[model samples]
Target chain A: MSTAPTTEKGRRTRARIVDAAAELFYERGVSATGLGDVIAASGTGKGQLYHFFTDKGDLVSAVIRHQVEGTLAPQRELGLHRLADLQEWARQAVLQHERSPVMRCPLGSLVVELSNRNADAASALEAGFAQWRELMSGWIAQLQRRGEARTDLPADDLADSILAAYQGGLVLARSRGDLRPLETALAMAIEGIGSRRAPAGRHRAHG
Target chain B: MSTAPTTEKGRRTRARIVDAAAELFYERGVSATGLGDVIAASGTGKGQLYHFFTDKGDLVSAVIRHQVEGTLAPQRELGLHRLADLQEWARQAVLQHERSPVMRCPLGSLVVELSNRNADAASALEAGFAQWRELMSGWIAQLQRRGEARTDLPADDLADSILAAYQGGLVLARSRGDLRPLETALAMAIEGIGSRRAPAGRHRAHG
Candidate 1:
């Protein structure tokens, strides 16, 4: 098959469409954002848009994959080498949530939006999560090796727990329209890693 | 304004529609489930559906309230007296997720879906969360009175972390399509309550 002369430019245009779609999908939602919105956001025509991606579902799948890579790249590169300093890592995570007060987790939003209706979307979500879990698990395994975390709890399980706290913090933060929840959750989860016994005689002040 | 003679029956029918909508909304998401689907699911005609809900947004608000009560009722019944069994309560929450593998937390789901586009929906979500947070803060306060959780973390913050973990656990569990993350995060949060010491090793072997 002979490639069209516009193939490279078309590829760039398609990337722009996917990027715009990902943002809108994260902001409004996958089902809520229509083809017109994507076309407008990408500054591409209707024909150009359909030429790049066959339909809305195809566009969504592409967006999910695009988001997965965008989100995973930094985390994978950072490499959890600092698991021994869980508090610092946790603080950084909290800061990430703080950076975006409204959006929360884009990938998480996508998963929740598409998990039930679209199997391909669900599988893509699961695969992305699997990669993320593996990355965190590797970090946790390092912590286990260093005795930073209890050897009794499976490193992967701990990693999952940590991820849950971070993700959940994001949800709560978004719901409350405040980042305090994220900070609190992340701090507590980090605090959990080092200690099993609560500090004595510290009383909660009633408001 | 004269009430219809069949007001009681109408109310019942409306309740059924909202209940069915809530379930489908939780399972398939609010954006995915249309008013027609709600009508079909509830076995109600368009006139009846409109008589009760007026619009899809109206129906959504009703469903949000319905879900809010469904979530808060059981916990409200638990009362301040159940503070001693906070760990047990936490464990039961994880079990709830385990038992219902496919059902994501509807309130959380709604918050994710509607937080951006709909103010009324967002306010309803915030109110629901606030009410729940108050209940949880009260529980933590009761625990503090009983000298259970460490006093250093404020009761509100403690409650926030607990809620954040559970919500985050739901996201993780939903994505992985499993309950282990929920279980682990809940256990870890609970363990963090009264201690700073690392928990005893009890690794479960994965076959």
Candidate 2:
């Protein structure tokens, strides 16, 4: 039970199971989905399922990590070194959502569901988000060093705002199936942080 | 049988059930919270529950509306007329999240869960968001009329971005159990629209 899959075939089977679980859980939600559906979708038998995951709880942990990877895989493909990279990243992100208009942010939608139900799942997601944010902060820090992004606000905070806006925009877009809410927010966000080497006037800080 | 509550007592009972459902769904999630649990929490039997709602689906619709009201109640109490109102409103909004470190936006978290499972619930959530955005846009329009806000951007679009950021900020803050993400996003959002009447140079527009 504690052994790793040594064979490539075994690893493929496990990956397939995780992928199927992610799609099902993402579409039907964690509670509404069953292992049976995952098994059916994965085209794996019960013995194979048990050989990999101990229970639904175990399978869910794998799904959470899988989702984190699914969320970040694209950005990993596209570089994040420049301010323009951030804009391109957000556009690709929103366009990805356009393909599936009803889906929420891949890692974010799961946060709310598991935040209270499963500690392990929530921790896994939080760790994933922290890693993602750290990576994003590093990019923003580079931008600040290059004087392309604002320096007054902490790099981490700027990255957090970008990410927060992305998640919120996804939620709104998903809620209405409109796609405009997301497109508009991200455009404004990219503009908000993408320029202005010097400070501009604003009212009532820390609202 | 589908029926609306006619008597004052009937309405109160229905409201009580919805409130209980909202608390449970908000904490435990809609999929995890059974109607039986809702009945127990609401102190009503199965028959009474059925009288108010045809099934669990019906109850979820009511829960969505209740959550919507829960979100807007405070903001509605205080008008959204001025930029200061938006600031005060955001401060209260972030403070509300401070009370609970692990909960996402009240209506937003629900959006992900129900966006696909139940159409009625999703529709209810969309309507709620639309109404909220409309009210906010009206206030932003008011500010624009007074030359307090940038008039170049459409009032509705700014409202959408603000709502989108709020939802995303809540998701991020909830994931990390820190209020900074939400606070930063809102402060930046408030600042993003509060000024900059002239054009600012920026990178590629709308990646």
Candidate 3:
């Protein structure tokens, strides 16, 4: 029902709508947020909204994609090559949670609501999570090659485990309105990585 | 607006309404489900529904309590005195996910939808998580006294970390429609608990 933007102005218009929608969805939830809310929040006309999105489902998918990009952009930038980077990643998450009013993962929050109900949004989220796992796995693989991590466990599994610790930690943190659960969970997960490890003789020598 | 049930029949009627609401909330989310949906799902009259619940918010709090009891019932029954018991806990979770139509923790699924928006529901959920964590920590403390777990780590942190792995792993598993992440994350978390432990020499000799 909608077409991709052809011009810079069109792209900007669509971006505005999606950004506004993403905020509303994160705060109120996709089920509770209406198109009228998005249009009002974005300061865009109904015509502009319809021109860019076919329906609420379409808009939800776009928001999911946007959230995926936002989540991955910073993670992709991180080297994730050393234990210190992994430690810093956990530290930053706890710090961010402390500063924020509500502790919800922009993407993780969407999964429970959309995964079973919305196919398009679920696929977008699945792809995003896969990319996240692959990036972390790549970093772990590199560390394994340098004898900096445990070679006994597959990098893919290790990455997934770390990801699980983070996701589960955030849920507990949100429920309790505290950071201790997230902090302890991430710390233990990072510590688990160093368990039964190959000595990082070569990697340690450089630093 | 609703009063406590003074009779057995009143208790059953209230429980029926709460059960119906919990299912609809889990499947469709709290925002999308209405009181009418509960009435239809429960085959109860409006008068009965209103008699049991002051409003949807009251019903949501009741559902949270129901879910907490459901989540903790099985956990309390487990002795959780050894590593094998921990492994079994993880295995049962993965197996349950495989068997169920949707992958979600009964209580966890509610946290994101209600944690920020509803104060009463938030308090109920926070109390449930705290109770759950305390139960897990109690088990870990018992293990520590028996030299079955790492004493270097606090029982509370270990419990929280394991909980995080279970929760985060479930989110990833639900997103991926696969069990590997949940399985790996939990396995690694349990493995971490036994890391650098005091030897269970006495228990081992008895075995």
Among these predicted structures, which one has the highest lDDT?
Answer: 3
Candidate 1 on B55-162: residue-level lDDT in tens?
A: 888788888888999999998887654444777787778777766756478888888878555777888888999999999888887776766666667788888888
Runs in model 2 deviating more than 4 A are: A1-3, A197-207, B197-207
Candidates 2 and 3 compared by DockQ, better number: 3
The best candidate by DockQ is 3
Is candidate 1 or 2 superior in lDDT?
2
TM match of model 3 to true structure: 0.93
Task: In candidate 2, list every pair of residues with a backbone clash.
Answer: A168-B168
User: TM-score, each model?
Assistant: 0.87, 0.92, 0.93
DockQ of predicted candidate 3: 0.50
lDDT of 2 by residue, A1-207 (tens): 223568999999898888999988888788888889999999998888889888887888888888888777767777678888888888888778778755587688788777455777878888989988987888889888887787777888888878877888888888887888888888787677754532223322221
RMSD of 1: 6.4
Ranking by lDDT: 3, 2, 1
Error of 2 at B6 (Å): 3.0
lDDT of 2 by residue, B136-175 (tens): 8988999888777877799999998889779888888778
